[model samples]
Target: MDMYIRVKRSKSTYFIRCKPSDKIIGIKQKLEEIIDQPVSDQRFVLPGTGEILEHIKTLADQKVDSDAVVALTLRKDVNEFEEVNIVGPNDFYQSRDADDANW
Candidate 1:
């Protein structure tokens, strides 16, 4: 069966088409094509619950259903991964307005 997930970051949302049996790493591989970030540098979390998805785990194993919202965080330095920072649409509008003010 085909399922899709929404992977979100700051001001960016990637609608990834996947299967329930797919490993978390596989999804990260797909994301690499779009974001150019290696799987080692990427981390996925369940939005709200903050449950970290393991690379060896499948979507079904993690109870991730169709249309689930997953937060994508990247490694900042050496040891720690950055916090989830999915920006909303309003932020874009506000930032654009702020940029216009500078013009």
Candidate 2:
């Protein structure tokens, strides 16, 4: 029988279905496919306790049942920031010059 579980990441939740005998790594792979992120960058944890889900254990070993919820977080090594353009004080004043000229 296939077991179903809900994985919550940030504000999004994903429902995954698999066999109880399936390894945790398999689930992580499925999550990678869904989220378009590598398994190495993913961290699965139990809700509330912050306990990490073991990669070597199966769904059965974890006692995961249908509709159970697991929390997903990015690994520390994964970059969380995106490239952004910073506006320095000089740049801000330069851009404001045009508007200031009209005043």
Candidate 3:
């Protein structure tokens, strides 16, 4: 029950994968900690849509028993730091390789 998350914007992207059993709030918190910022202070994205859990429902209906890929990205441009923190020109976690080893 792992999840793949992509936090990005026009210029950058940060890809993160975690167990779905891990709370989304926790993931947000961890990313904030990694970037030295707060979750609310950053942009909130839910993959294909801004609405969270859509990925869950979409996959569930398809009977896909695989990890969820939730791409969280900013719809508009944010400030430089905010962009860098959330999604900037230098996001270091892009094109991440999937690691099922955690499971």
Number of clashes in every candidate structure? 0, 0, 2
- The candidates, ranked best first by lDDT, are 1, 2, 3
**lDDT for every model?**
0.95, 0.75, 0.48
What is the alpha-carbon lDDT for the whole of candidate 2? 0.75
Candidate 2 regions with alpha-carbon error over 4 angstroms: 78-103
Better of 2 and 3 by lDDT: 2
Residue 50 accuracy (lDDT) in model 3? 45
lDDT winner among the candidates? 1
Q: What is the lDDT of candidate 3?
A: 0.48
Model 2 shows how many backbone clashes? 0
Compose the digit string of candidate 2's lDDT tens values, residues 13-103.
Answer: 7889899998889999998988998887777777756667789998889887778888877755556622222233464355646667653
Which residue pairs come into collision in candidate 2?
A: none
TM-score of 1: 0.86
| Candidate 1 wrong stretches, greater than 4 Å | 90-103
> lDDT at 37 for candidate 2?
86
Model 1's C-alpha root-mean-square deviation from the true structure amounts to 3.9
Q: In candidate 3, which residue ranges exceed 4 Å CA deviation?
A: 52-103
Screening candidate 1 with a backbone cut-off below 3 angstroms (N, C-alpha, C), the clashing residue pairs are none
The superposed Cα distance between candidate 2 and the true structure at residue 61, in angstroms, equals: 0.7
Q: For candidate 1, what is the lDDT?
A: 0.95
